[model samples]
Target chain A: MVYFDNAATSFPKPDGVYDSIMKAMKEYGANPGRSGHKLALRLGREIFETRELLAKLFNIKNPMNLIFTFNCTESLNIGIKGILNTGDHVITTSMEHNSVLRPLKVLEKEGIELTIVKGDYAGRINPKDIEKSIKKNTKLIVTTHISNLTGTIMPIEQIGRIARDNGIYYLVDAAQSAGVYHIDVEKLNIDMLAFPGHKGLLGPQGTGGLYIREGIEVKELNQGGTGSISHLLEQPDILPDRYESGTPNGPGIVGLGAGVKYILQEGLDTIRKYEEELTKHFIEEIVKIENVKVYGPLDIKEQGAVVSINIGDEDSSEISYILDENYDIEVRPGLHCVPMAHKTIETFSQGVVRFSFGPFNTHDEIELGIKAIKEISKEL
Target chain B: MVYFDNAATSFPKPDGVYDSIMKAMKEYGANPGRSGHKLALRLGREIFETRELLAKLFNIKNPMNLIFTFNCTESLNIGIKGILNTGDHVITTSMEHNSVLRPLKVLEKEGIELTIVKGDYAGRINPKDIEKSIKKNTKLIVTTHISNLTGTIMPIEQIGRIARDNGIYYLVDAAQSAGVYHIDVEKLNIDMLAFPGHKGLLGPQGTGGLYIREGIEVKELNQGGTGSISHLLEQPDILPDRYESGTPNGPGIVGLGAGVKYILQEGLDTIRKYEEELTKHFIEEIVKIENVKVYGPLDIKEQGAVVSINIGDEDSSEISYILDENYDIEVRPGLHCVPMAHKTIETFSQGVVRFSFGPFNTHDEIELGIKAIKEISKEL
Candidate 1:
């Protein structure tokens, strides 16, 4: 099957990732940092080396500032819940995954003020709009680096400058950009960044992390044994141990390290260039098909690999079903967990079919995918 | 290496667990519940099946009540932080892991009243003492099924009955006892139960779960997109989705399903009996050595496989280092993330060396471990 759902999670990960997980479980499966034995200490060092790799990839200064989480959603929750408090104003865009929008709404109900700037029809957010939304009480400016629904890349660097100019904390949700596109947290002026290792990093599921800048503290989201301060009843006041509160997914983290090492070896530019060619070819060919309407910027440079479209008001799930069963091509359907983004694109009730590409996706697969959609459009 | 730190995390998971994880990743690593496609739907079904297997093992009537977490510590945080409020009273024992004790301390500092009853010298807690500590405003009664430091089993059935009799919420942290011992939540009058999959369940690390009884709602600890309520920003008030807000550890959970299925087939009594024999024999031999002092009830019927001891006035870490470097045996020497339990056992600053056995441990390995400890004591 030709899988085009990399936006949800990348499939067919680098071979080293699977091997690393198996090696971790079979050779040294002991709990890291929870014991004083050789295997446990070795596992702990493996975890730290992974942190260093991530720090190098993201231009983070201190590796200890990175905290491993279960998923990008959990990282977002920890950032959103840890930093914001009552009566503080937060600025965000209408185009965001429910991971960002839901937590803000929960906080808004509890008396936090919110300003949601609208993204254009092409799902692009203006940096000036974010700056204009700021108020004296504004404590944060958070935006998704790339819209998951339309793949429109936001101007996070410009927004980051605006946040710095205002002395407010800037957070970039890097769910769609971590390993696919280059992210230098230090250069981008981003104070907090959340990313999923399973996606662009090509790691297995259940591996993700949050990078919090020094001097910023979010209230602990989940608290327990960090394996550091066992003598104290209170959670330790350390870089990651303060925020991280349990036995980390050790095997998953090791696999993630392998994935990131592959990325570093392959070079981010090479991987991004490959996916870009497939995405550009897809958009250029598919728009000529009869009665098909596409969303987001048609320019490949302005968007990530995600492409959404509909066929003459056909329900997206129905087309996706036909594509899966008859055409043997897997594409996602529905709102893609960004309902507000769908409303902005005018596909609120009838969601659009999403075709996302990965680094390993070939030109042949994209050609087959376009052929499948052309056939589906004719039937509709 | 002879691994004897199964309480930290069981090593060499029963053969099929690693294979199941690999199968999940290679065949269908799609994001479950986030889209409507063949792979995603199949994965969602697989996750549901895993939940059913866990429910069957714990005697839970509703499979949806079991929510998978990163570890048992995350489960405990979700339970403790979710159920308590300011001005409410909570009763707990001193022989609890920091997973339970740390969260309670955080809550206590936030104005929640706390009463920590002391365990006896043998690490046993009297049920009447717990009942006497209850107050009119008591909202939660939480305890560990077995102390991590000493392996002393708590009177959870009696405590569960008391909490039920008083209409208080009862939570059991079964980190050390799950999968190796029988735990029927319904029969024990348990309102909530937290367990780790890596310990006795023989799954990989990063897999654990919490079972909340029907009709009870704990505020969500981590909130984000659950895919079902995409139209609304507020978190959906659903069973598993309410607490589980992120993309789950699919491969790990599938591994956990295989692990739990193996336990169900092997019979909990058989596994418990094997570990019991190892623990009983280790204690019987180790105590006869010079300058060795063991903690916990000597009876195998009253404890788990965790055995803690120290050579007279010798730092446990030095001996553990010797054990690792010279004898190639793995034993944990530290606070074991349960300082209160260590304090109760009179090993606060001088922590004991912990040698925990698993079902796979053989009589010959125990004999070797005993000989190694005897040699270390002679050097002391």
Candidate 2:
């Protein structure tokens, strides 16, 4: 199958993910940390191992600092909700996916202050715009590392430095960038990092994490069963346990550890180069179509692996339907869950069609996909 | 492997669980409801199927109110954090698992009025005591349907009526009771029901759900992707989506659905009878051992499938360790994450040994287990 919807969730996970998932089920798949049985102990160790791998992957100091979540949305929710309080000010960019924008909107309605710094039409958020938006009470600044719709990488290091110099916490939502590209939390000075396990991380969809740099404390989003403190009625002040409640997705997280190992083995730099080449080639070929309008940064170097565009006279939904029914190709259509970005790029009423490429997507598949689009565009 | 720890999370799931998990993964594992794609549509249907099954099982009015969660802890967290407010009065029992207690404790410290009613020695909280504890400001009451540590079934129907008469919302933490017993949400007037997917539901470990009755609102606990309203910043105030944030545990939930199917096919009443027989026989046989003393209600019809006990001159840990290493019988030691329940039973630091039976357990296994405990008592 031609799986182009990696942004939704990477299809056909790394080879290790399947085996690890099955192994956990077959061996000792107990409710981790809830019981003192041997199986539960083994399961607990695997949960910790996954955290350690995530820590190493993200360059976190302590594995406990890594907060496991249901997905990137949960992580971002915890990160945003934990830090941004009522009467607090925050800044984010328009290029963010709905996951970032929606939470901020909720907070804004709750008497929290927010400023959405506009990214360029190319989908890149400028550090200066973010810096200028910061108010005296701005406690946190959040931006997507890569635009999910356009694949535009933000200059987050610059923003991180600005936030640091101004004594503000900088959070990067790395949903589309993690594992597909390099992210050094230390050098980036990212106060908190939110990412998906199933996306670039190649873990199962249920796994995700948040990295809070040592001291930043968020309200416990969910609290129960860390297996440590049975006496405490309230939330623990501990790192991962503070955020993580209930029995974790042990089998799913163990699979994620394998996904992390795959990334380390293959190296993110190599994958980035491959994705860049594919994006450049796909862009060069797609531009030849007479009625197609591509969005975001034109150059592959400045772009993310995703491509959002519209074929004239065709709404994104109809195009998406034709792509699946006629061409046997899969691509996400509509707002891609970011209405703000669509309105910003003037695709508000009719959302743009999104085709995101993953590491496994070959140029041959892209050729067939483009051919199908061209066939539809000719009539348009 | 005599998998005796079903209360921790039932293992060796019914055959249908694996099939459903694989089927969902192969057929409709798109990021559920995020797109208009056929796969997403199918995925959405499957998610709804699980919700419907859960609603049917609990005798709930609307399946949409059944929100998917990571585990029971998450369900309780959502239920508690969403509804409980500062200065609002809340009532819970001392027998609750940490999931319900911890979040309430946090609220307690934050100046929420909390009243902890004692369970009469059997971990059984009297409904009259609960009614007496309700203050004029009491907004909600949360209690465990079945004690996690002692397996005592609380008087939920009576408590439910009291909460209804007093105009207070009542929540039942059904972590240990879901499929092993039947619950009628409407009949009992349970405003919200929290359950673990892995236990009586017979699903994978990571899955669980919260069932909220119609016309109820809890604060949005986690805010992220609901896949329905991409334009909204805050969570949609619908049923499941309002509480369930992020990409859900699709495979685990798929397995959860299959597990529930197995329970429905066999019949919850039949399954409960099978477990009760096991619990009774196990209790009867173990009593033959000279030094054995059982905890919780001795009546099999009244309590659950769990059997907690202490043998004289033998520490629970030492007995549990010997059982696993020497006799290949698995059971949980330590505090069972319910210190208050242990205190109620006077076990305290010396936690009782727990032998929880399930649908898969056999009479021979129970005999071997009892004999092994007999040997351990002899050695002690």
Candidate 3:
């Protein structure tokens, strides 16, 4: 099947990912840091090395500042719940997926005030609107690097500057942009960045991380085992250990390292260029179809590889079902876990079918998917 | 390598588990719950079926109540943070792992009071101590089913009955006992249970879960992408989804299901009986050996398969190193991430070598391990 759910989880992980997981499973499956055996210690070193790699990739000065989490949602939650307090105002946009929106809403009930900046109908958030939404009580600004629903790349750099200038922390949800885009946290003034390793990084699901700037501390979201400070009565007031409680998903993290290595070797710019060319071809071809309305930035260079669309008189789910059963193409349906983003595009009621392209996807497959969508529209 | 760190994580999972993960990877690597397509839906159904199987194995009422997490730490955090609040009090024991103690300490700093009753030097907590510790304001009483370092099994039935009598919530950290012990949550008055699927469950490293009793609002631990209620401005106040955020580790969870099946087919009770008998024989033999001090309950029926000990005049790490480097016997040394328990046993500064056996371990292997330990003791 042609997999187009990279937004959910990229399939056919980078070649080395599964190999690394299997190798670890066989050779050093011992609990890292929990045991002192040679294999166990080796496992611990492998885990530490992966964290260091991730830190370097994200331009984080200290590797420990990166906390391994289950996925992007867990990473974002650690950041959202860690720093946001009751009565603290947060600036966000309609471009966010449920991960950010749900946590922010929960905080709202706990007395945290939230200011949601409205974005363009295609899910683009203006940096000026984000700056204008800031209140004196605002302590944080969270915006997606790219909207998952429409694939519109937000002006994260401009927003980051705004947040830093206001003495507020800036958090970029790099779930969509981490490996696909160049994110220099230090240069971007990005205080906290959360991302999923499974998507653009080409790692397996269940691997993700959060980058916490040196001076910022979020309330511990989950507390348990840090594999360090076994004698402490309280959670260690350290970097990753403070937020990461419990045994980490070590094998998955190793796969993440492999995925990152693949991306780094291939170069993000090259991958971005190929993905843009494919998406541009897709957009140009799909727009030729009658009564099909596409969402997001028309210029492929301006956005990520996500292509969302609604065909007149056809429900998104119905089309997705036909595209899957009749055609061997797999694309995600509904709001792609970002209903607010759908509302921004005025597609909340009907949702939008999403075709998220990855490096493994071929142009021929896109043609097949487009052909299937065309057939689906005709039936409707 | 002789891996005695099974309690931290059971290394070299049952061959069937490794095979199962590889099979899933090769057959249907599609992202589960991402699309309504057949492959995606089948994968999603596999995840739900795993939940049902887990509930059946544990005799739980609703499968949906079992929420997947990254590890036992995240699972315990969800159960703890979801159930308790400010001004509330919790009762636990001194033998508790850092997973419980650290979270409680953080909660205490947030104004939640707690009473940590002491465990007997053998790492046993009295049911009466738990009873006495409960206050009128107490809302939850959380304890471990089995100590990771001590191998001691608490009197869960008695404590569960006490919690039931007081109408207080009872949560069991079943990290080390889920498969090794046959526990009916309802019979144990267990209102909530948290555990890692990777350990006794024999799954991949990333799998874990938390089970909450029906009708309780488990304030979600993390927020993001629960697919449902995309239009809602708040977290979906529902079972499972309220706790499970982001995309799940499908391969890991599926592997967990496969692991549980491997146990269920063989029967957990039978496995428990075999492990108990082995533990009894090994403990009797080791206790007779000179210059060795054993930790945990003397009776195998009341403890677990792990045997923690130290040779006379030897630091635990030294013994562990010699065991691995010379004898090729794998074992864990240093504080076992539950230093609180070590303090109770008066081994706070001196960690013990921990040898934990899994079902796959044979009696001959135990005899060989015992012989190896005796030889190492001669050097000491």
Candidate 4:
């Protein structure tokens, strides 16, 4: 079977990821930082190594600034809700996934002003529009680096410049771009970047992180036994520990380290280029079909690996089912938990079927995907 | 190595746990409930099965009321902070862990009235003290089933009765007593139960759960893509979906299910009995050593599978180091992240060394641990 739902989660992670997780669990599956034994210390050190690796990958100066979370959604929630207050205003784009939008919506009910900058029909968010939305009370600018629906790469660098110039905090959700894209937080002037480990990073699920710039104080979302300052009933005011509580996913973080190591060894640009080629080929051929209405920039320069399309106003779920049942090809359909993104591209009712390419997706598989879509479009 | 940090996290989980996690990751590690594909459907079904297994264990009638969390800390935070309002009052015990105390302390500053019922010198809380502390404005009663530091088992059944009689919600932190001890939510009148999957349940790290009784309304801590409601900007008002947002620890929960299955197959009584015997032998022998002050009820019927002791006024860390370095016995020596419990037992300064046994611990290991303590006592 061919899998093309890399946007949701990347399957068939690197062999080292699986091996590292197994070894960590079988050999030293102890609670890190909670005990004083060798196994616990070893696991704790290994978890730090993973943090350092992610730090290096994301160009973070201090590893402590990166806090591991359950998923990017949690990271996004923390980044969005931690900084904004009742009177604070925030700006975001329509291209973002529900992870960023839903949190802002909830905060809106609590008197936090929200300014949603609209995107074009192709799901492209202009930095100028975001700047225009800024008010005197605007405290944050949050945008997705890559749109999960249309794969439209937002101009985060320009938006970051605007935020830095205005002294507003900038948060970039790199859920769809972390491992395969080059992101230098300092160069981009991003105060916080939230990323998932299981997608382009090729790590197992249950691993994600948020990198907060040093000296930027964001209130923690959860407080518990941080294994430090245990004598105090109050939560510790330390980096990472201030945010991370209880026992973390030790082996899962070790696997994430292996994934980052794999990416560093293979070169991020190489992996990105390979996935881009597959995406470009699939998009070029599928758009030629009679009834297919492909979405996104349709250019490798303006898009990531994700591509969405519809067949003659067909329900996205039905077409996805046909692809899965008849062609043994897997793809995601419907709104993808990003209703605003669907609305931006005028596919809220039709709900485009999304085919996302990963590092492991071969050119031959892309050809087969194009063929499957061609046949399905003809039938429709 | 003898692993006696089961209260922190259970090591060497049942072999089926590891195998099930690997199979889930390699075979069907897709985003469950996010995409409409075979792999996603398979994983979603398996996750529901785990929920059903937990519901059966806890006697929860509706499995949908159970929500998966990252750890027991998050569960406790949700259960504690979800129901309480600004003017509401809460009653808790001194035997609670930092997971319970820290969140309540945070709320105490926000106009929430908190009354901490002090436990006795034995780290045991009297149900009568809790009953006396209850006020007319009391909205919740929180307690730990077993003390993480002293292994003192609280009278949760009696406490639950008091909470029920007063129309107050009862939240049980079953961090140390989830899989080994029987927890019938309905019978105990527990409105909410918080538990860690990696502890007594013998699952992998990064998995935990909170079971909210039907009709109990608790606000969610995080909101994002729940995959159920794609169009609504608001969080879906569903049972599990409202609380569980974003990509969960898929394979981790599968391992947890395998762990619950192992407990069910081996019989909870049998597992509890074996652990109890180990605790009884270790406690009886260790208490006989001179200069060693054991903290807990010390009786098999009163205590669970945990024992804390200190040797000859020695720093608990030094003795724990000797045990790890000289005898290769793994024990935790510190406040155990429960400062109030240590203070209640009058060992706050010289924290007692904690020896927690799990299902995998044997009589031979217990004897070895006793011998190590005996030799250490002679040296002191």
Candidates' DockQ values? 0.83, 0.67, 0.77, 0.86
What digit string (tens of lDDT, one per residue) describes model 2 on residues A1-380?
A: 57678888887677688778777876787778776668888878988998888888778889888888878888898889888878899999887777888788888999999899887777778788888888889999999998888888889889999999999999999999988877889999998999999888888868888898887767767778777776666566877777777778888888899988888888888888888888888888888888999988878878878988899958998998888888878889887777787767778777878888888889899898888879989976
Model number 2 iRMSD: 1.7
**lDDT to native, each model:** 0.90, 0.84, 0.85, 0.93
Residue B64 lDDT, candidate 4, scale 0-100: 97
- Model 4 C-alpha lDDT per residue in residues A94-148, reported as the tens digit of each score: 8888889999999999999999999998999888898889899999999999999
Interface RMSD of each: 1.0, 1.7, 1.2, 0.7
Which 10 consecutive residues of model 4 chain B have the lowest summed lDDT? Answer: B280-289
Q: What are the runs in model 3 whose C-alpha is more than 4 Å off? A: none
User: How large a fraction of the reference contact set does each model reproduce?
Assistant: 0.80, 0.63, 0.77, 0.76
Worst 10 residues of 4 chain A by lDDT: A371-380
Error of 1 at A370 (Å): 0.3
| Predicted candidate 3, C-alpha RMSD | 1.5
Q: Candidate 4: DockQ?
A: 0.86
Task: Indicate the worst ten consecutive residues by lDDT in candidate 1 chain A.
Answer: A239-248
TM-score of chain B of 4: 0.99
lDDT (Cα, tens digit) per residue for candidate 3, span B1-380: 55556788887777777776766665666677667877678778889988998999888999988889889888888788788999999999898888888888888888999899999889999999999998999999999999887899999999999999998999999998998797898889999999898889988888899888888777777777777776786777787777777888887888889889989999998988988887888888888888999998878877898889988868998888888888787888888888889999988888888888888778887887888877777766
Off by over 4 Å in 2: none
Top lDDT model: 4
Better of 1 and 2 by TM-score: 1
lDDT for each residue of candidate 1 in B138-227, tens digit (9 for 90 to 100): 999999999888899888999999999999999999999999888999999999999998999888888899999999869887777787
Docking class of 2: medium
TM-score of chain A of each: 0.99, 0.97, 0.98, 0.99
User: How many clashes in each candidate?
Assistant: 0, 4, 5, 0
